[model samples]
Target: MMRRLSGLLLSLCLFPVPAFAQSKPCTVSDHPEYTNKIKEFTTESFFSTELVDHLPLSSCVPPPDAFLHHIIGAPDTLDYTKDINAYFRLLASKSPRVKVWSIGTSEEGREMLVAAVSDEANFAKLDRYKEITARLADPRGLSEAEAQKLIAEGKPMYWADGSIHSPETGAPEMLMELAYRLAVEDTPFIQKIRNDSIILITPIVEVDGHDRMVDIYLQHKKHPDKPPYPLIWWGHYVSHDNNRDNLGVTLALSRNMLKTYLEFHPTVMHDLHESVPYLYIMTGTGPYNAWLDPIVISEWQEMAYHEIEEMTKRGVIGVWTHGFYDGWAPNYLLSIANNHNSIGRFYETFGNGGADTRVRTLRPSETSREWYRPNPPLPKVKWSARDNINMQQSAILFGMNNVASNGQKFLSNFYLKSKRAVAKARTEGPVAWVFPADDSRPAEQASLLNLFVLQGVEVHRTERELRLRATESGRDPDAHKEKSAEMSAEKSAGKSPDDAKSKEEKKPAETVIRAGSYVVRMDQPYSRMADMVLDKQYYNVSDPRPYDDTGWTLGALRNVKRRAHAQSRQNRCSRRHRRPGQNLPHPAQYRQHARDFAFPPRFRSHGSRGRFLRSRRPEI
Candidate 1:
């Protein structure tokens, strides 16, 4: 009997039952209508609740369903933003691994919150990790050994925000469930992510809009026959146009998000949106933004392809990329990360705003299989909010798993990209961009400078006047020709070439940059952002058509007088003289300047307490 038992044990060890097989089946479905609709798209294993609840969980922390009183993605049910915030606070209070804090208040007075999920040990060293990322983000004085040491001790912070558009109601719901899984699940996958990376989630980006959307959705559910009531405005002053305010930083939501980004320096920023086939991870088609680091462009594909591969491996279909959107624009909501040397990506899922199941018939073009989209969506599939939630959650999990497993790679690349940005300023031209203090439009100039400061760009005011030679300054085109003509005339007059050269050296084109000018040097880590915003952008005309605006030259748009100072060979001004002057005034000082400007009637009515300049808000 002992020998037989030993043999059976050995056989069991060789081929153990799967985790799901050993756990109890998920028999509870709060909304079978929504749950049943996705059955044709994927199996139970794809649903996040099914997979997460099967794992060992902390009894102290209740799952989202227990707290929300219904499973997320249930039909005709939408939790208000207040309830969501309350649930996040509850998670933070219950779990040592989770912490929630308000970033700022929305325009409509709703609190915008962010939740940080990680292992308890990581939480203990949270400040240390934050410092490490900050150093890596601007590696100027950092040494090779120091960087390697920090990389060994650092954890990549992955940021995922949802529902910026508000009408795409599935993201915030899915995010709430995602936070619960990360906080409570004790499975290997969850533990690995908790141990290796810090997950930061903003459940609802547009808080006011989320509640409005929920109200509209519920009202529409009441009268199925009547056409849905139109939400004339999603934000206080804008609708879907809120996503276009990243570069402009006009909206309160944009400023709050930028503040969070500057503080955390996350390695990845993932924004979730809805309205696509089944799912589309963003690897924008062509005519990519010229100002973004090449590595960032590659990183987009790296993350997108990794998500596609992982999802495909799990038997999920319609996980595609490299279509629909072009990456030529830098004013997108996610462009903040892309400009700051971080991987910024987004997801577009399929949902009809509510939990009701709807059958979607695909055209032949969408149904046909392609290289980017291996297994196309079915010709007709019963889609619901639950289906949207499952696919989004699964894709997000795979993405987090990738980042967690390759934490070192992500950290190292982040450091490398910042290092490259600093080096480019030295080797390449355009050492700095100078925004003059004597511009006719002082308000606009100050507002533009304030925008850079808000975006975390290093801004300094010159203490004294600067006399710089226009060696490579693109201004004064006739100056160079006139000098050449003078030299030619001297040579024609039988003067030696050396004499002409000496005469030319004495009278080179000189440009004076007055005192109090704002200087944005390219030697810093976020110099790419400064360059992209201040420098001209020439989109490649030969590439595919752009999906959005081709140019967002802030200086040109704002009518701010700026000059690019190239590295000069003959300028007498020492490096110390050309160095950045005193740091620009505090953000509040700029806000004071912003208030004095004359804004449009619509924006002026919103009052002076807006984030930045109310009058000069970009219309884009």
Candidate 2:
């Protein structure tokens, strides 16, 4: 019957049949009563369900002036170039509730706005941070404005950033819409959140990347140097994948902005991104563990975790954590540096394994399938303007107003536990786990000590096959020295395999190279994800991951990127240097570390906390 049905379809395609009456056909309907009915029937067809998804993909188009309009009490648009001019214009106007500033600029020369949304009282106080205006003068660079503004006037602040991933289309629109609703509407809704809080919003962090998208639409041209990462399609892609360089070596945009942001010590922050193939909208596609300490978790739970829990209970969204690499740090949690209590979460408009049945249903529905789902720390509330106020209230300043200085003490305890565990693993774990062991002394083991500290396992070494192992103690205490064959033969025969411990299962006594890549691997793991909140620093890099690139070394696996970049520069120099037999100086001068790139002396004022890091080495 199946074969006959297929054959009939084939026959219809092969032989052109008459649409009307099928002339002389005593067969069309095969029933005397149905012959007339068959003639009256009309044929209409659409793509099959399976074929429908396969059709070209479609994206949601957000309204124009998305970012500028988000600042409530007023809605405005300013060209990326004329942002400062427009900002001052607002400052000069009656929009007492909101003020805008060009807080950071991207690698592409586009300006990112920092909206200071507050009530009249807060706005008057925000004016104290005028150093932001100094940066606009073009000497310090605009990125420094936010910090300089706060520092110069010594103003306390809270910040929210979005669109570090240009493709994380959700946040730009979400945040922009938020800014708009806040600006355009006047109600108890926006007032509650803005009363005590002054929002320092960086709507677009990666302007260089965002411009790539804008370029494709307007100029019909693609930049020669686009960072490589997953795109709309899993198969076709082109990028150096640079934005992940949160450290900022080759790209100065995020790197510089991060430095300035840290100075302000914001209390609230959230970064956004679209999920890649096999990745979660919440996190990467590796493991679902988070680098958070119990204290960090506790803090978030106190403020934001409850909200997420409520949302999950209500089934407004699916559980945030899933997939192998799903567990990782949310960029916004960096608020701790400035004593800010922040929760970073992701939104998934689309699922990882491609669109499922719901996606199909939503294809014709509204575009609010996924938003920020706060699981444990955030209080469950409907996604609305009032919730934004509630979110701001959860900041360190506000949280402190409620918890007092104990908030810091509580957060400190949580971080210490997580940090101690890691420090111990780095100190006592077996040689494999010690990693590029400390090179303080001239011993082989000491030389093996690594200077560069890697995050959770990542592909670093270009060569090596490795695996993971655990033990009751970090030093592999379970390991026993081997006895002579004659001494062990008799006892070995009677011993059960289960009674004997194997290398792999012993509670991770030490971490070892398990697979591809070299020494570069993540020191953090899902098991210790709860530990990330203990310390945000990488032991080596002053900046955070994915944003600061200066911390990476020039040897080992990192050598590949450094070398490739140098080679490119060398070619450019060689071309400009040689003039047909003109000898370009014999010896080229190599600059020292700090001189290579005019990095200001990276220093910190001495304080009691400095005592702990004084030894620098982990006292595990």
Candidate 3:
């Protein structure tokens, strides 16, 4: 089945099939005599009852002092940090299947935790599994034989993180319950998941915001007349947009999450949230984002649709596809994972009020005739805490089942897609992108290099200055488009194509690659992702709109001299330079160095000179 799917995808990529007309299949009749007349039809045709019967059955056991129980009986929402930590800690302390680690500290002095839940045996050797996944992802340091060995040993790791946004309340609670079920339930399906895969669950990504939200909700209940202010920032530095820091990775939370993401190299990852729910999954409200590789999107859709089908068969209501959310923004953590050749899914459940209080909100089916009501006018429906919890639980269950059932295929797809990326870079693209290290702006150069390192892009430094083939004008697609537009307008106004641009402007320039210049080459395993981040990506925003910016060139942003290099006749590899910060001086350090040496260049600040002069030392 996996081979068939892989072949189909490869064929589609190599030779796309055009639209073909098809005739409708014979239909089954509801009439009793018609059931017998249609041999292919039966009562269980739409959904196989036999498959559901064969599913691993289990009993749900509520913990004696479950936090959900306490929350239900309590008058107001409670601080999740205290209760959540206590619950997970207790579970880990008691169950061999569960292990908890504090991944990092949040902005407001709270611990961010990730719980690893697997079978007891897998939990014992979890580090081995993590290492295998990491090696498989990069493969630079591994021999072909060694890579094959690791691939055989590797188990798919599925990551799901919650509550990155404060108001998206369902995920944290659902994760707690899911953790309990995975740890306690001895069902064959749960056991298979534990045995075949490792589940990484970060119950709350934004610890500070969660506590703040709880406070706001508890306070709001006390004064019903006062308006509720449930929304709070995930980061102290950048408000609700902290989740959009995958590219920059400046915030501590994003840094921590990236560390785990790269470490485990999860085959599938989920960033859980509550939006204008109407039940939507990650690949979004429209066609899958154009930037994503088609093969991966095909695999992801297969996995998601299967789960949705199962959910529907079991009578889970309002599970929708294609309504909201576009997957264009790569800065989103989920899309970041997708760029890394993993199946990254976004789970958006309908959100109620902060404390799971019943609130008047619009259901998808509801409509209104009021003058103020717009198209698809949603009428009010009361949503409760219980419904939110159940929906979230359903999402986790479907996701886990998907991974458990398709673990090997997921692993194969990840490896194959990466291989395709490497192939594309080697056979198709320009040699590499060279960011010439700016000696004058050492700090900014160092910052940019560090960003590349954070993004897991392999980097090389030149041993000596060398002239390489380089583009002159623009670094982004839009810039190139603008340049072409200007030339086109000139040509349209009766100017010859050659006369439209001067000979000097038409020719490519040779850029001198400095000794410390960073080289991100094609042919590396993560070349596609590196290209996406560093190169100019074109988007058809006029048609199906992108969620965010189409082109994001980190090289262009830092004011570094960027050059598109063709394959060098001479070998480009040189001695590896890993330490970016040590090689370059920071801007402040540059000023301090300038002051001590009494340099001719003017510094950014004058007040610093007095203090620097008092503590003058020999500049490096």
In order, what lDDT does every prediction score? 0.75, 0.31, 0.61
The per-prediction tally of clashing pairs is 1, 80, 0
Structural similarity to truth (TM-score) of each candidate: 0.82, 0.41, 0.76
After TM-score superposition, the amount by which residue 217's alpha carbon in candidate 3 deviates from its true location, in angstroms, is: 0.5
What's the lDDT for candidate 1?
0.75
**Candidate 1, residues 1-620: lDDT per residue as tens digits?**
99999556444422213222214432322334333433533333433334432323344665676677767776678888888887787777666778887888889899888899999899889989988888888787789999999999999999999989988888888888889878876678888899999999999889999899888888888888999988778977688989999988888898788778877889999999998878899998978887778898898899889988878777778889987898988887799888888899999998787667777788898878898999788888777677788889988888998999999999999999988987766776477787777776666776676667667666656666777656655443234556789777887898997886676588658778787676776776778888887877777768787888888778777766887777643322222221111123333444556665674111111111112211111100
The prediction achieving the highest lDDT against the true structure is 1
Q: Can you give the lDDT of residue 408 in candidate 1?
A: 95
Write down the worst ten-residue block by lDDT for model 2: 564-573
What's model 1's TM-score? 0.82
Measured over all alpha carbons after superposition, the RMSD of each candidate to the real structure, in angstroms, is 12.0, 22.6, 15.8
